[model samples]
Target: MKVVIIGAGVAGLSIGWRLLQAGATVTILDRAQPAHGATWAAAGMLAVTAELEGAHAAERDLALHANALWPGFASEVEQASGVPVGFVRSGALLLAPDAAALDAMRARGPVLDAAGARALVPLLADGIAGGLWAADEAHVDNRRLGEAMTIAYVKAGGALVPQTAAVRIEQKSGAAVCVLTPRHRYHADAFVIAAGAWSGLLGDIPITPVKGEMIALAPPAGAQLPGPVIWGNGVYLVPRDEGGQKLLLVGATMQEAGFDTSLSPDVRDQLRAGAQSLIPALKQWVLADHWAGLRPKSPDGLPLLGPVRSGNIFVASGQFRNGILLAPAIAQLMADMVLGKTKIIPAFDPQRFAPRFV
Candidate 1:
């Protein structure tokens, strides 16, 4: 089968790779370089228990399933692309501000006292209540993962067309025929709109862009970052060793600012403050890097998966903060749906928010 997937973010690239592995001819079109969007800008947190807090049942199950698949998925991508994506099982520390909040956190994992939390990281602030220790939490080098997926897809015989922005889907006889781009029309048996924050622009998809800003902090001389991810003060500090430099990634400030990715000093200070609140020594950490990315969010705060509106055209967008974590599951499910091997998941159906006539 011939398949054309729009957007070349992790979702699109992974799906294309899966389809190619299944003997289907796949072509991925991206407006810019593949995986340079949210997939690159993400903190790469595989916080199954932390991220899924208050999440609905379907999304929770999907996240857990994806988390379970990540180990094998990382290995497969690495073997295919010959690149180490820096997948780590370094767990996470989620701190609660008060006793009531600490009690609520117990449902997710073991509750750690303030002393215990400090013992795990040794960088945590003193005047803390308690936190949850989620041992199953993990993280990956998202930027490296993107590069690896791109290489893996191409190595698997999939055509990747960068700078090819798909404008619209051309349909005939109630079936998607091709995707029309500025330079060329891509004819295929199936078309997928996985264009991250831009998915809504192409069709009736209700995806919107939620902008998030992040900053990296490098420890001072003789100081080192904590081994596990630390979450509190409305920020998550993810430790990463890039090229032998250990840096703490402090993020993020969520805004309704549509498609605006410019950095702000005020936001940077705000992130630093949040990080310092958890780890007071962060005040001495140097600000290494600051950037922003747009997350694709739906109205219902759930991903839009499977078919868009009863045609071969499908959508695998609106993953919001979980895009990097959900890539493997999205790829497998979308590939199965495209191949008629599995039914569309009801909770994630793109047709859930169908336009109604007044």
Candidate 2:
């Protein structure tokens, strides 16, 4: 089968790779460079249990399944592209700024005193009352991962068209036949809309962009920050130690601003303050970079996967915060659906929100 995928981010690229492996000729179209959307700005956390505390049972199970698939997925991508994605199962540390926060963290896992927390992360501030260590969580360097996926997809015989904006899906007899673009039209047996925040532009999918701002910091000379990810007080400090760099990613501020990628000075200062409050030694580090990306969010806070009203068109967007963690599983599920070998999960069906086709 010939398949055309919209949006060459992680979802579209990964799905293209899988479809190519399944003997389908694939073409991926993107408005900009691949992986320049939410995938590039994410902190690549695979926190299976820590992020699923208040989530529904189906969501939790899906997250766990995705987490289980990461090790193999990372290995495959690395081998295929001959690039290291900096995948690490270094675990995560959850900090509590006060007694109340400590109590809340204790409910999730074993809480350690200030001294114990300091033993794991020496730079932790004295104001920290306690912490909870989740040893099963993991993280990946998302920038490297995106590059590797792009290389693998192209090497596997998939075509990528950058800077091509898909205006809409052209249909005939109630079936999607091609994707309409400004300069060209792409015809295929199947169409997959994997556009992140821009999925709604083609049809009536209920997806919105949630803007997030983040800052990167370089540690002082001869000083190592910490091993695990630090989560505390609505701020997360992710350490990137691979490739001979001791950089900490401190983020992020979530705002409902529409399609704005500009950075804010106030948000940068707030992120710096929050990072220093958690790790006092960061005050001596240098600010390396700051930027923003828009996350595609749905009303139910879960991804919209599988076929929509258009018989041959499928959607694999609205992954919100867990897009990185869920990419591998989503690619497999989407490929299976395209091959007519699997059933869609009821909770994530696109029709749940009454999607309209143009």
Model 1 misplaced stretches (Cα beyond 4 Å)? 355-358
lDDT at residue 191 of model 2 (Cα atoms): 93
Model 2 per-residue lDDT at 175: 93
Model 2 TM-score relative to the real fold: 0.97
- Checking candidate 2 for backbone clashes, the offending pairs are none
lDDT of 1 by residue, 1-358 (tens): 9999998999999999999989899999999999999999999999898889789999999999999999999999999999999899999999988888889888777999878888998877877888999999999999999999999999999999998888878877677788889988999998888899999898777889999999999988999879899899899999998868888999888898989899999999999999999989889899999999999999999999988664788889999999999999999999999999999889998888872111
Q: What is candidate 2's lDDT per residue for 222-296, written digit by digit as tens?
A: 988689888886889888875897789998888989998999999999999999888878889999999999889
Considering summed lDDT, which 10 consecutive residues are worst modelled in model 1? Answer: 349-358
Using all chains and alpha carbons, the TM-scores for the candidates as numbered come to 0.97, 0.97
Summed over model 1, clashes come to: 0
TM-score of 1: 0.97
